[model samples]
Target: MTAVLPATLAAVDLDRTLIYSAAAAGDTAGLEVVEFLDGAPLSHATPASWELLAELAGRALLVPVTTRTVAQYERVRLPVVPRYALCGNGGVLLADGVRDPGWDDWAAGVAGRAAPLPELLGLLGAVAGQPWVRTVRAAEDLFCYLVAHARDAIPAGWLADTAAAASAAGATLSVQGRKVYLVPAGLSKAAGLLRLRRLLAGEGPAPRLLCAGDSLLDAPMLLAADAAVRPAHGELHEQGWTGARVAVTAATGAAAGEEIVRWLIARA
Candidate 1:
């Protein structure tokens, strides 16, 4: 068995952090399929990332903290199976591939204080039939999102107004490329990471928290980490976000994923 790092917890994001879709993955050469949809490859990893991740998983408690739902996350076949994972922006947690009921309860409590899910969903109902939007759906019933085909085609001022409305409703809005996420204000990846920390508290000394991501939603988790990293591109990079403890990768796209895994391994 790969020797494990008992005092290092690496909470990493998947998409654009360690995995990438064809459109987001800059160079396809030396890429390996990590996710599939309908029997076709949908997401991929750099050859170097795939190799480094195996080592990182061995050196730390690598928990994937992603906005993907549990069902969607299961589609990714990583080099190692993480014992703990946070999905749906911390709306769901999984242990050994099974959904954790207590985590669900915690998520419910967080969501309860926000606008009702249906109300949040209703806020985006108008986009369902808009030509710019490709899909409009609720995620794990804790959040909603809209996939857009053309960013410029989105009606002007609608996003800002919607974001403001979401804020007023105790919800938050984030735009990541084609997807726009509307999540409960307090339901964050950082919160899930904290819960994991609490669950692991008495097992041993507190592990050092390391994180990586490339999105605004990931900001909280990254900030909460002892040290974090973000790629040179993506939502956060586009906005020029940086933190005292967060490092920015020199590479972008698939190569950046490789760099991130390497960072975790080096730090761990």
Candidate 2:
């Protein structure tokens, strides 16, 4: 059983939201490395964001909701270890650093509504053998994505056609940086947030939800919140997405991460 929480429930994405890579970061000065891969710095956060995030962790239930798989999510080392995290686009949830079995079951039950994983993988054949595609693989058998070089070089109608096809297959497609993702319609960050809300409500009063993200997948989770914020760059911003209560950050890259953390701390 968990105790009541007086602070807000903050659900934030990882890459390009709270952290940024060298290419995505624009500038690294005054930023701290939060993740490293093969001994190389991979993701970074502004020093101000780091200090503010630590403070936010103390004042709120700061949950890192991300599209990364559990293993990949583990690679990140934030200043504050959040009590809860949703990885695999919410197909996997962790509580107090341990995977939550109940949440896994819930996600599995919902997955049945979507096409079989094999069918989803078949969709990959479209991009397979393409010169621009760099890597393609499944994540925890929950979703599939492909990283491409020169994303803008792909045929204009290709993504739209593929997205439409994915929708018919009971999934949604999103483009984030060099990655093209196809996620099951039934498995969503919003659904996971709902489960979190239910679990927290069982412990005490319902907490206000505040979310932040910079990509298309993050849009659902952001929209599900009582209030949300997004960086000026990324898919949603490019799409000109807007909501009655949602806010957009003034900066982009690593600097925007600091602005977003400050936004959460002030509201939380």
Q: What lDDT tens digits, residue by residue, belong to model 2 across residues 86-203?
A: 9988899898889988878888778768888778777876677889878788997788988888668566688888888889999999998888888999898888887887777785
Index of the highest-lDDT prediction: 1
Model 1 CA lDDT for position 114: 95
Write down the TM-score of every candidate. Answer: 0.95, 0.96
Off by over 4 Å in 2: none
RMSD for each model, in Å, please? 2.3, 1.4
List, residue by residue over 184-228, the lDDT tens digit for candidate 1.
Answer: 989999988887786786555677999999998999989999999
> lDDT of candidate 2?
0.86
Report every candidate's CA lDDT: 0.88, 0.86
Measured with C-alpha atoms, the lDDT of residue 207 in candidate 2 is 83
